[model samples]
Target: MSKYKCIIFDCDGVLVDSEPTSIQVLVDIANAYGANIDLDYGMKHFKGSFFVACKQMIADLTQRELPDDLEAIYRVRSFEAFEKKMEAVDGVRDVIGNLNLPFCVASSGPESKIKLNLGLAGLLPFFKGKIFSCYALKKWKPDPAVFLWAAKTMGFKPEECLVVEDSLSGVRAAKAGGFDVFGYTAHDPENELQTLATKTFSKMDDLLALINNEMA
Candidate 1:
């Protein structure tokens, strides 16, 4: 039997290769609004956060309040970028297909953005009704509430669920919620996630093997 009853995935960098593109969009938006931020800075500071957090970070960095429509602008630009560049993480589909346990996406992103990116990457069918968003829960990552909610709603206890995450905040949230977390490190050159995750993997195949081994 699988050790985990369900696998919860963080949508952005884990399932879809959308983090670089999304962070680039954030950098461009911040620059356009007079913030002297770059992709590296944005990725380091904002990789796991949502729009609200991003806005606050920009405000603090630039020492200026963002335009009232900043979030709207970000959504538009991010969707456009995603439409043009989003792709599923290599081999993630195969891993999902081969898994016997149930799985779902729980993300800091709003439901609409999650749906848009997943649909664009053709990973939506795998998740469908299994998508959970912080927007709906009104609690974001690093808070643990969203992860805990996903566990309960999916009919699994915290210890019965495993979280696959690519961000530090996501890993922290999963741990805080009492779930074992596997961190994806393919995109994180800084190795920030490894310390927070129960285990870390650079490839989807490796993650699959780890899961299978754990269950065995």
Candidate 2:
């Protein structure tokens, strides 16, 4: 009895527990560049943003020019960390496995990073060709083009899709793209998503019932 025909999932926090490792890597790199950000700052500003935006913010924060290989460096460190510790979000596999509807992952990362993280987390098999990346179009969340593309390619109108996202940028993207969004709040420490998302849940185990309008 769900209204949506397709589900568009945000990969990092929603599918794989990737934000912490990724943000830690970003923090380490930013610190090396003379920036003073900690993990919390990284999560707040860098979590859902694309590389260009992140780079500009770093420059602003440090007031110093970043190395040309800044992104490359971060990628190397983050991927290594992911390989060692990345895992799917708790109970996510159960929700994904039991869903009767179509689903796909649309992320702010490049296609390669998306695949790597999902693969490392053992969730890639479910996504395969169903993954969509903002890098494909050079547009990231808060722009909404990526989510719109996912819905269109999945053969659903924007209104017929539900976007499950964990970040402010992703939530803004989904809402702007005309989709109903369910905010996964485990990563939402500031409760910023509470007022923005169409619905919100703190646990992945609650998602299946939530999507089907059967949650108690």
Candidate 3:
């Protein structure tokens, strides 16, 4: 049997390469406002939180309050681009499909946003209805409430679950939730995730090996 009965995946960098679409949407809005914002900031602060990034971007460049409709605008544009170009992370399907343990997604994004990205990547069907978003839990990630919620909803305990994540914030969330965590570094350099992760893997085959080993 697998060490854990269930696995929870973070959606963005873990299952899909949606950053390009996200970054482009942010840049498109910045251009509309004639604001000069660095793309690096988008990659860093903006990866997990949609509204936070919108407000921060306005503050960073224009030194002004974010427009009331900016969030809506960004959402619409992001979905448009996401539908066009989001691609599943390499090896995600093979690993997820072959895993013997039950799994679901616990993401820091809004539920609608998570569904959109998953649908775009064609990974939605794999998750069925097991997608849990941070927005529904009354707290966002780096807090662990979302993961805890997923575990509870799945009738599992934190210790009975394994979390696969790609970001420092996500690792912190999984740790806080008291779950075993495997940090994925496929989308980032080892140095980027090593400090936050207990163990890291650059490919899904390696992760499958570890999972199967744990089961064995």
- List the RMSD of every prediction in angstroms: 1.1, 1.7, 2.1
Alpha-carbon runs more than 4 Å astray in model 3: 31-35
Across 91-160, the per-residue lDDT of candidate 1 in tens digits comes to 9999999899989999999999999989998999999899999999789988898889888889999999
Winner of 1 and 3 under TM-score: 1
Clashing pairs in model 2, backbone N/Cα/C closer than 3 A: none
Model 3, 62-104: lDDT tens digits are 6666688887888888888887788889889889888888899
Clashes of each: 0, 0, 0
**TM per prediction:** 0.97, 0.97, 0.90
lDDT of all predictions: 0.89, 0.92, 0.81
Residue lDDT tens for model 2, 172-207: 999999889999999888899999999999999999
lDDT score for residue 167 of model 3: 79
Tell me, by lDDT, which candidate is best.
2
